[model samples]
Target: MTAGPAEALHSWMPHSPCGAWCLPTGDALPKVSPARRALRLATLVAVVLTGPLCALTLSVLGPRGRAAVIRGWFRMVLGALGVRLRVYRPGALSLAPEERERPRDRGVLVVGNHSSWLDIVALNALQPVRMLAKAQVRHWPLIGALAARAGTFFVDRPRLSTLPATVAEVAGALRGGAAVGVFPEGTTWCGQATGRWKRAAFQAAIDAGVPARPVALRFVVDEQCTTAAGFLGEETLLTALLRTAALRGLVIEASVLPLVSPEGHDRRSMAAAAEAAVTEALGQPEAEHAVPEVAAAA
Candidate 1:
């Protein structure tokens, strides 16, 4: 997840908001009070409600039902966070007539440029998606528990053997009509740099024989709401969110571009196509500015 670009990619682009807006530092943005408070209250409600509701619902329904419950739960979390989603026109699903004719048209994998954990809430609120998170996230205290309950697919990068199995699980999930979510950037950023698009996760959609839809996310807030200190570095889950929302006002935009079929194309081409669409939607005029050169994941 980037504020926008990694340093190398940032170098390639012409002029960028990265230099002007991004703090010269670590993996976060300046925290604002209103945003921090809004996020905290929303997360608190989600923590309180998700457990009981997800428990009853997941227990009663089958896997599909449970997944739907997770979708609703995530939407609730986004609403609590005071996030409003805006989609650019012509950014709708790229489905044929027959696909649109049916009600159960399976949702595709939502491949995105990740910025913050907030990206999760933003996508969940705006799209039909279930996120793919790191295996270590499952061990985190409160948020980890919620992720597990939501049936999040956690990947362990260190274990080579587990990678295929994990990918297989995600493929199965996608075939079963779940919209898989992935952050191709691989790491969180300080709302500044853009990141390289990871090829592996996009391969999952190709392997599953489904479309890998592009989604671009950006953090925008009233100046009164964001601050340098609270969001400057690696901060705790509760404290960071609370302080940012309490002071900063935040609105995350989720614009989904057309789906790219995995058939007969390379990963880089797919990435370029998605990047172009997202960049245009975000109102960045230049292509080189929109698509960053390959960089090791931040």
Candidate 2:
């Protein structure tokens, strides 16, 4: 018998018990040492106090200079959190002849898995991007002001009526040669399993007719999956921040997966394809969220 859409995809989407909220069932996380905690606290304080000054300087630089500033800030923030970032394109050392000649100027829509707030810093460390953030982030303490100054787009998710405008803004940004980063999951999930990719962000890629780049983020501590990095459940921002700051040997590995062209597909299909790409890159079984047509095509 042939498998149904969900079942066929489920065969590939294995759950990682250690991905989210490492607890009784999954591998437990290590306790943070007092000395390390104090060190991290000092680092955070320094970054927080100096970040705005850096942003102010960034405002005066040209586009290339601004990108440099963003990358530098990302590196600084990751260092403060004690999370090392490793970024590499898959099979980059062995590119095909045809791919070698492929155009590198494609305006990108970066769609990635969302687990921790640290994802933003880790990803930006690899490449500077205009991030689409929730409206509440505009009010976040020091980072909020810096993010706005650096041109982060804010969205009001609860209001369905505002989506068209947001999509248009994202498309405009892409058309003007700006790369945008969006978390397609719409909400945080324990790193164990990625949730469905919301179709809203994909619409921007569709409208701009650009490649939707899939990025997969994996957070590890001592070479093991760490739940201490996830910002899920009832965890408040402060709680999550404190937990991440206290973590030692945290490493974020970001894999830039294959790009999904939006030429022939609608928003839902594009989202499903991007989701599958990210899941596969993360070593999870291939899965499509609520897009049966995509599964059928596969």
Candidate 3:
């Protein structure tokens, strides 16, 4: 018997091949004094504790005001974690004046490669967008509550039947003129390597008739790329947090690539184009050992 759409999708969910082995080792990994790390962690806790107040304040603000507040809060979070952010917008500037401003006028599907949890914080620091996150994140401590308040769409990866509904919800939000962010690479990887685009979220952009804005994220320490910030394999959230906090001089560079039009392109083709753009922006060739889709379940 032929399997249904959701069933077929379940058979091909994307998973990263990267594990603990991908992390930086020995002298390659930068470290801060223990006291500095503790201070950073304490600052992060204090900032997170202010989230509820921020959420309350957002209730009274207009859209633009709320966006400004959210961006400020995210920047604070990044600062507390000792991560500096640098954004490059060559693509936005390269567009015609009106075209460049169109993103603000209409809904846009923001797509990017996934590397670390910090990627979400960095993206929101740049611009407030409703993110598509795994359902597990919805149950995470304080952060989960904040994400829900920020309008995150949570997808339960293990629930095959719910895939279609999740896509529909994302498309609906896009159609309502909200910028929705999705990491087409369904799972996170070490910053040094990235996985293939899964294509499900790309379909939402096609259905909503919006352009796909491709963004690239890179983590650097001491002017060199580093994977110490990655949350993968058997790593726990606390371990990742401590690891990230212990790293000094970490910089997150976000590059906004050219917008991809959905005109005359199917979801698969659109996904491929966006993936290629991000790959080029990161200056890394596509992974030669990208685990096959069929083997993703393993």
Candidate 1, residues 1-298, lDDT tens digits: the string is: 1222222243222222332143323535544365457656867575655566565667788755765666566656655655544444241244565433213546477877654666777676555466887676888766688778666898765455676788788888887777888876665544445556666666667777777777766655542222232232334556556543442345554555557777776667776677666656655422222323111101
lDDT of all predictions, in order shown?
0.58, 0.72, 0.80
| TM-score per model over all chains | 0.71, 0.82, 0.89
Q: TM-score of model 1 relative to the true fold?
A: 0.71
lDDT of 2 by residue, 60-103 (tens): 88877877777877787777777787665665446566442224
Pairs that collide, model 2: 12-285, 13-285
Q: What's model 1's overall lDDT?
A: 0.58
Model 2 clash tally, residue pairs: 2
Best by lDDT: 3
Q: Cα deviation in Å at residue 88, candidate 2?
A: 2.8
What lDDT would candidate 2 get against the real structure?
Answer: 0.72
- In TM-score terms, candidate 2 sits at 0.82
The better candidate by TM-score, 1 or 2, is: 2
Query: After best superposition, candidate 3 residue 200: deviation in angstroms?
Result: 1.1
Worst 10 residues of 1 by lDDT: 289-298
